[model samples]
Target: MDNRAIGRCLLFLGDVTEPGFAKTAFGLRDWARERCVGELRLPQATVSAGLPQLTCEQAAAQGASALVIGVAAPGGGIPDAWVPALAAALDAGLDIVSGMHVRLDALPALREAAARSGRRLVDVRTPPADIPIATGLPRSGRRILTVGTDCALGKKYTALALSRGLAARGADVSFRATGQTGIMIAGSGMPIDAVVSDFVAGAAEILSPAAAPGHVDVIEGQGSLFHPAFAGVSLGLLHGSQPDMFVVCHDPRRDHLLGYPASPLPSIETVIAQTIALGRVTNPAIHCVGVALNTGGMDAAVAEAEIAAYAARLPYPVADPMRGGPAFERLLDACQETS
Candidate 1:
């Protein structure tokens, strides 16, 4: 999506209790809050963006230009009840932006509303029609993917931090956003989860192509290999990115899948092994570089202690990029090592 096309936006939240699925709202709040004017929450939604709650009409009056469906809805399909609410936003002169699997144009309500209001229907999830299949050929340069034990556990944040850290060290590098929220925050990226199942890996290949031998691409990873709901996307991204090194990201507080409570989250060691075994299909030399813990709201001392505990046990660097210090510096140092 064109970055210029987006203006002050009003995010629409589905009844997603878990932060993992509703990352779009939270990511924008943390990264691009200026662009997020307000939020329209469904009655059933238990979570909040902590922004001024407003209706589409009220948001439009305040100069909101777009209504973003900010939740990764279960099954990726738009619920029938959301159609009318979305149409109302379009009717209020706000363009509709969604990264859901369903195309906004496909819904008659939204299609007709946009026609009447002369607004755009932006679907970031749709891939280009001419995308080629993944070749699995070795590419130049180096790549580091921030994989995780489950969804929304800091993969994108870790990748972004690493990219900035690498650039600060005078390395040629870029952040490759893969998921919907990451795509929105980066302003442009391949929606790896939205691609047709057969072309998912192909989409990833195009997302981060070959670069100079000295260049590094800090690729934001997708779902976990252990998540039954999104493991396919995770595997596709791993095979396509073909990273020389990967960081295992995890939220120590989470023990089970966000939505599927019965399914336990995989251990960091398990994730590291699974990533290597599966990623070998495209990049045989792939291995773990570090571990990034998501200690978002943890107390400073607690977070530091957690990092220290992990570092003492794991053979690799362990740190929270948000809680940057000597430990995080160590992780960045490991990531930049090409030899």
Candidate 2:
């Protein structure tokens, strides 16, 4: 299956009452709509928080070619209840694209369903073969990385936002996606965490330079230094990207790490300090350029005040890219100053 949605219409399956892992689906939908990746069909029975949701029948009727399990469900497995609807989508001739660590094709029932319907299953998290170890060689051109306070705290969104904002200002900017959602939208990227430990930094090194020599590569970061389980991957990306400038992506409302509530969230200062310290291990000149806030689930006034507070605290531009205006322009200015 083509990594790019292109002519295909997609039905995103994410309809839980409390969105946890499914939150990434919202980002995917937004990217698809903004980039015109393909048509998104909304189902009559589905309703999500401000996002269009579609049922299997509606998606098939609307010429949707694929049903994407867009959420990163807990334990990386599809919910048992979702299997029936996914099977129906397969019967309707829609392929499956899943980013979860669990491979849908490996499930006997789902595999049989796909075979019976002649549909394909694309697992984005499956690592590629023969990935090399990092050489730590220097590369040309300036690069920017989006480091987050916690996992899934809008690092990818910040990278995408900066890419768009810089391009609008007539700057040559390119985005390097390091996660599954980004790969789905950007058409190509290495699933860094899935790659072997030895190859994680190598993958980042390879991807960071794929952009044009003069264009600024806005690299998407993975995991968080505070995330105990995935911090190694974050360190590898920091070292491999060799970023000259960095952006801190954070959600001010989150007081604890997702799925790990016992772990208290670190201060923004700590996150920035740790990120810069790690980056300097490979490139001593790495500097943080700005902060991107994910002000979801906050009142407009409250969000504005919080963002203002962050800007005052940080020595650089801070803004929520979702609400574009002066903050976004300041972010672009910061990027240009580094470029």
Leading candidate by lDDT: 1
User: What is candidate 1's lDDT per residue for 134-248, written digit by digit as tens?
Assistant: 8999899899998999987899889988988888989999888887777777778888877888988888888889899999999999888999989999998999899999999
lDDT for each residue of candidate 2 in 25-103, tens digit (9 for 90 to 100): 5666677654222323223324343544455556666666777666665577787667777777789778888788888
lDDT of 1 at 7: 73
Q: Name model 1 segments beyond 4 Å from true.
A: 1-5, 14-21, 42-46, 54-63, 260-263
Give, for candidate 1, the lowest lDDT window spanning 10 residues: 1-10
Q: How well does candidate 2 match the true structure in TM-score terms?
A: 0.89
Instruction: After superposing candidate 2 on the true structure, give the runs of residues whose Cα lies further than 4 Å from its correct spot.
Output: 1-7, 34-58
lDDT value for candidate 1? Answer: 0.87
